[model samples]
Target: MTTICVDVMGADKEPAVLLEGVAQALAADTDLEVLVAGAAEFVEPFAASHDRARALVTTEVITMSEHPAQAVRAKKDASIVRAAAAVRAGEADGLFSAGSTGAVLTAATFGVGRLKGIKRPALSLPFPGISGRPTVFLDMGANADVRPDVIVQFAQMGRAYARAVLGVAEPRVGLLCNGSEETKGSEMALAYHEALAAADCGFAGNAEGTDILAGTFDVIVADGFTGNVALKSIEGTGKFVLKRLKAAMGASLKNKIGMALLAGSLKSLAGELSGDEYGGAVLLGLRAPVLKGHGATSARAVCQGTLAAVRVVRAGLTEKIADACELSA
Candidate 1:
């Protein structure tokens, strides 16, 4: 059975949302189980109600503003720390949290420990793609400053993710750049291309930002700064388009009738673009699977994120990444 430890506190929504997520997860997968870390009184009742969920009972909660490293060490019983510890101690197969991203990253790296040959672990997000699967985009907001070697690492991990989650046997890896030309990006891009081309994975050469959602490649690699900006832009644009569509559909009775005629298709398209459907990003290259849920996590989003983590754990991503990292190194 695959067990995932989830931090049930410090999300944009209440801890109760995580419980809703747990109930959804139990209903979705028959072979999955969850361990929740948070205040016992508040969380235990929910755990008792669910056959697959168990509460760890933690008192300390780490807020976004707290120092990640210090809070981790000082508050041994903090939800995030204890969640990571569960993975480290073999009590769970993975960890999930919608808490402070920095603290979660710190806990996964320091508490659970980095996999062998991993210099820096990356936050890999699945961006909506035209081909009905999300393109694995790495360094979503982890490590603003990166090296060529780091890009190489991202490429390997991203390919593994696409293969595992998306059922792509051999994913095409692209280095995100300003233009499609090999010489278009900065020195880092040039260096990355050179290194990635020789690596074991399928290197698709330079890809422009436009190619991200166009299904040009299954895996897209970028520096954290660039990747984060692109991710936010994609998210904002998706929201903007959805809002405009809603307004246009409700503009008049005639338009509303037309929308009603195409409502099924529109709903499908909306689901394709919804971030909640995709759940959240995975922090790659760690010793165990770690999923970072959206801060404004809904019940559906939590369910999606937990399921994604289960996919990663069943994929044996941690062991596969360790083997691939050594080869790339």
Candidate 2:
């Protein structure tokens, strides 16, 4: 059975709401077991009611405002900290948390540990694209600054993610830059371009911001700073477009008729764009998969995130990543 340690605290939503998601996940995946970590009051009752779930009582909770490294160090009994320890100690195959991104990353990196030879673990998420396939993008917010060699490994990690999770065979990789031209971008991008082109991983060349969702590449790698900015920009632009569309649709009775006809398509598009589809971002290059959902995630998102973690464990994602890194080494 695939067991995932779920940290049910630290999210904006109530623990009960996240527990509802755990219940949903358990109902959906009969082969899955969950180690729900949280305060005694919150987890005990829920675990008692669920057959596949067991409670790991935790006393402390990591707040979003606290320094991630310091909080992890001070709060040994914190829910997220304990959850990571469970994964490290073989009590769980993976971990899922909708908590502070920094806390989850810090705890998982230090507690669950990085895979041998991995310089850094990257935060990766599958971006839904126009081509009916999701593009695996990495370094979403792991390392703000990275060297060319690190970027190359990010490319390899992204490729492994695309293949293992997205089921893409021979996934093409791209370096995100200001322009598609080989000569465009800062010295770092140029260095990345040179390294990726020479690396054994599939190198599809430089990808512009537009190519992120244009279905031009299966995987895109960037320094965490740039990747995080690009991700937020895409999300902001999507929201802006949707808001404008809603306004336009409500502007006139004629538009209402048009909206009625397009309602199904629009809903489908919204679902695809919603970050909930993939549950959350996976921290790649770690010894075990660590998924971090949005801080304000809903129960449905939590359920999806739990299932996504299960998928990662079942696919032997970390093993594949280790092999890829070793081969490249």
Candidate 3:
């Protein structure tokens, strides 16, 4: 069974919203277990009712206003902190949260700790591609600036992830750049281009932003700044298009019937652009798996995120990454 620690206080909808997702996950998978961290009053009752769920009994929670590192250090009893501690202590297999991104990163880095030789933690998000397989992108927002070694590490870690979780053998890796040419992109992108070329991991040439969802590559390596910007841009455009599409579909009864007839197609298309279908973002280079659902994530997304963590753990992602990457530890 895959036991995961869940931070239930800081989500957009808080304890109630989180419980529903936990319940959904419990109902869906008999092999999955969740230990919810929150006030005793909230978590205890919920855990009592569910067969696979347990209560961590935390009293404090880190909010968005508090600084990430400071709050983690001071709020020892915070939900996120306690959850991470649980994973580190071997009480849980991994960590999952919809709290502040900064808090999640800080907790994972300090509480669960990093793998050997890894100075930074990275956020790797799955981007749905045309091939029905997702292309993973790294350093979504962990570090705005990273060295060449970090970028190289991202590719190595990503390869392990694709193999373990995505079931891809010899995943194709790419460096995100303005152009497909080797001459384009910043010095860092160019540096990794040369580094990956010599590495054993399958390195595809530089890929443009348009190639991200085109199924051009299985892994895209980038600095946090560029990767975050590209991610938000893609999400924003997807939302805009969906909003307009909905408006057009609801314009008239005729369109409604037409859409109803094509509901399956539309739903499939929407799934491709949805955050829920993607199962949130995974924090890489840590001792254990850590997944962060979006702040405004729905109950389904929350459930999917929990399931994603379980999948990663069962796949032995952490072990695979440590073994594949040459670490000092």
The prediction achieving the highest TM-score against the true structure is 2
**Per-residue lDDT of 1-329 in model 3, one digit per residue for the tens?**
88988888887776888888888988999999889999998899999999989999988988877799999989899999999999999999998899988999999899999987776879998888877668998878899998777788888898899899998988999998999998987777888788878876678889889977887799998889998898888888887876776787889998778777877877766655655676789999999999998877667778888888899999999989887687644
Q: Write down the RMSD of all candidates, one decimal each.
A: 2.4, 1.9, 2.0
The order by descending lDDT is 2, 3, 1
Instruction: Mark the 10 consecutive residues where model 1 has the least summed lDDT.
Output: 268-277
Q: Give the alpha carbon lDDT tens digit for every residue of 293-327 in model 2.
A: 98887889999999999999999999999888874
C-alpha root-mean-square deviation, candidate 2: 1.9
User: Which prediction has the highest lDDT against the true structure?
Assistant: 2
lDDT of 1 by residue, 44-159 (tens): 99788888888899999988788877888888889998899889999999988999888898888898888878878999877777766568888888889898888888998888
Off by over 4 Å in 2: 253-268, 327-329
After the best TM-score superposition of candidate 2, give how far the Cα of residue 271 lies from its true spot, in angstroms: 3.9
Candidate with the larger TM-score of 2 and 3: 2
Collision pairs in model 2 = none
- Which pairs clash (backbone N, Cα, C closer than 3 Å) in model 1? none
Candidate no. 3 TM-score: 0.93
lDDT of each structure? Answer: 0.84, 0.92, 0.86
Candidate 1 Cα misplacement greater than 4 A, ranges = 64-74, 247-251, 255-274, 327-329
Local error of candidate 3 at residue 76 (angstroms):
2.0
